[model samples]
Target: MVMLFESSTIKNITIKNRVMMAPMCMFSVEKEDGIVTPFHLTHYESRALGQVGLIMVEATSVTADGRISPLDLGIWSDEQIEGLHTLTSRIHAHGSTAAIQLGHAGRKAKTNQPAYAPSAVAFSEDEAIPTEMNEEKVTETIDAFKAAALRAKESGFDIIEIHGAHGYLINQFLSPLANTRTDRYGGTREGRYQFLRETITAIQSVFEGPLFVRISAEEYHKDGNTMDDFIYFAKEMKKQGVDLIDVSTGGLVQAPIDVFPGYQVPHAETIKKAAQIKTSAVGLITSGRQAEEILKNQRADFICVGRALLNDPYWPKRAAEELGYVIEAPKPYARGWA
Candidate 1:
């Protein structure tokens, strides 16, 4: 079997293929209530029907003020569970495992409410200077993640991925460039990792299913996290029993980055080897052959397709064609797919 189409297991969940639909925020939530709308249902279900093995729902905020935008999906309230449950049910019905990305946008939040972060810094001049979180707020935010994980379990998600990358709440605490606190939560590298470590521990307390953490392995700034820093973080995650590391780069106070196909694969490979952990490679990986090469070489265990899937919900079928691999289609599309 082609490595890309090969089945893999994490915890007790088996994914039919290595293709994971990366979480991309729809910014389509109506009424500003943070609930999943019909648009989300159709949007995600179409990818499931297209035979993607793991459908990772977008960066859903754990609190109302933590949203990247007012329209982002949320898991902060129990009332939002029903819509997410329906979404997961639909994805599972189409033979795909459903996962949700639990996140808080931190200083990147674009809502009217004041944003919170590890320090009172602005992501950019265009963005507002966020409030520096105190010990009370820190504990509260960690509890929010734990609460969100419970909601994820209730929502019928098979996997829960903490959104620790992309200069968001967790990333702010992880990146020295973003986190400049003198308290226990900042200062040294170990201190910087404290927030994520606690967050992971908190979620694990309530969540026993497969847990994944996405990280920006390569922050473009000179003073940002080095590969060594990333490797240390990965090792800590491995010790914590994190099932996978979805590796992506940049987005922490972005500097100039040279974009290329599979540019980020090496980081994933390095982390997988150094940390002795499974990882998912993402970023500009737009073709089946490219994905196959990554898996065949054991660079990463899974491939996360983002914008490409947006362009084609049937991206897996297109990939199968490119790889000359005959992937089984949904019954109704069998004739056309064949």
Candidate 2:
């Protein structure tokens, strides 16, 4: 049997397959109000119809000013719940589990509003210097994440992933390269981890469903968090009741990286073994056989396809054919698919 096509359970949810459509931001919001648009509905539902097991929505901001871009989706307000509910319902109708990634851009935010970060640092020379988050700001942001998780539950999502990767607010806090402070929120590795630790604790208070945290295991710099640091973080997450770690690398700061088809798989494997937790391998994993090899060898529990799925909404069907395992298609495409 092809392991990629096999079912797996997380919490009380049974995902039909190991193939998950990795959350890639569309930045397609018609208005700056951060509401879901028709394009989003069509974009995500296509993958669901194509037999992908999990369709993770893009990075959704928890606050208006926390957005990476004005066009990013928002769960900061109750009004946005209706549109997201419709989206989750559409995905479910086609037998796909829906997940949303909650994120805050921090210093990387490009909006007109001033960005906020753990330290008053600029992402680059060209980027604006962000305001250092004070005690009140930190508490407010943590509360924002907790509130967003509740909103996700109200929207009918099956899972929630905290976007702690890609050099965002959480990453800034977790990485010593970006965070430099003497307070409890920075300095040592444990101090740097305090923000994410609190954020996870906050989200868990309200969200009981399967929770996942995506992290950049390798920061690609000498001073960045090492593999040992990542393993410690993963173990801590497991103790905190996180169900999975979606392992990806880089994006903490500007640094050269070697890119390859399965470059990020090794990190996932290391984290899984070191932490004794489930992990999803992402980054350029483009074929069924490759993904199957990883799963068969127990390198990673799930495969997250990003650009490959964007290139072809029916990438899973093509993968099934490559592995000589047929997956049932949506009824409308039955004639062509068969």
Candidate 3:
């Protein structure tokens, strides 16, 4: 166990370190067409060169209706694949593995126009209420995921992470509180798990690399989903060839969370224990010691930092130095190390 410093493998891919840069939306893309502009390339390349082991690209929607923002990257068609390929190639040149986060906004879809969801519910005070998804739309959504995985492979990504966390369409379906359908998609726990299970199986057909699913370990509502749901989902996902469970919490409804240092680590612990699968702990993880403890305790397989890396893109190199690794500063910065 002390050899936790050793490299880790998931399927065909290997992460040099367990440190990953969490996917966070920059909402910086000026185009509504979801093109990978200079801003996207620069932002990701900076982290790769700065020494992050693996950087999951910000949530890229599988369809226009799946996007969190109009400017978010989309893989709905063949045209979008080239731009992502460019970005992935750039990350590889910098010696970091590139991962694409595929998502669907679901009920969270639409901001200005007609929104959609598993049920007619408003997620936030300002957001519009969304329409429930019919069976036809659900089948299309699964195909969209499969297509997105294909695009991720075309773009040369080392891994593809399905965005099932944060009250997105997939998570909305996972939670009985949000998913009220009586058809094949809702009702019993297995029924609620169907969407994710099918989505994973569909995507697996296209992506042979390491597959990841970011899930809300706890929906944070008495009536909503819980850790047990995610644990069950994790085991099923593993059986379906999912490589890791990116552990996260809440986002079913817009409510303030009582956050503290390493607040969601326990969520990862519970899921890891129950599912006995590789898990990635995210949210409020800051220091090296805290990250190290998570690894040592078998609480998580990966420690993902989003805003923390944004604040200091060089944090990985600094973290390595602090954690007793011989970190090599950039050639330009090496003189300062003297």
Q: What is the C-alpha lDDT of each candidate?
A: 0.95, 0.95, 0.83
Question: Taking the tens digit of each residue's C-alpha lDDT, what string does model 3 give over 1-338?
Answer: 22224578777787767789999987776768888999999999989878787989999989887788887888888888889999998889767889989988977765455666777767877877788888888898899899889888988999989898899988888888788889888888889889988988898887788988998877767887666667778888878878788988888887679999888889888888888888888888876777888899888989999778989987776666667765566676687653
Candidate 1 per-residue lDDT over residues 17-64, each given as its tens digit: 999999999999999998889999999999999999999999999999
Q: What's the lDDT of the predicted structure labeled candidate 1?
A: 0.95
Model 3, residue 69: what's the lDDT? 81
- Candidate 1 pairs with clashing backbones: none
Question: Clashing pairs in model 2?
Answer: none
1-338 per-residue lDDT for model 2 (tens digits): 99999999999999999999998989998889899999999999889998999999999999999999999999999999999999999999999999999999999987889899999988888788899999899999999999999999999999999999999999999998889978999998899889999999999999899999999999988888999999999999999999999999888789899999999999999999999999999989999999999999999999999999999999999899999999997888899998
How far is 260's C-alpha from truth in model 3 (Å)?
0.7
Better of 2 and 3 by lDDT: 2
Question: Which 10-residue window of candidate 2 scores lowest in summed lDDT?
Answer: 120-129
**Preferred candidate (TM-score higher): 1 or 3:** 1
**How far does residue 140 in candidate 3 sit from its true spot (Å)?**
0.9
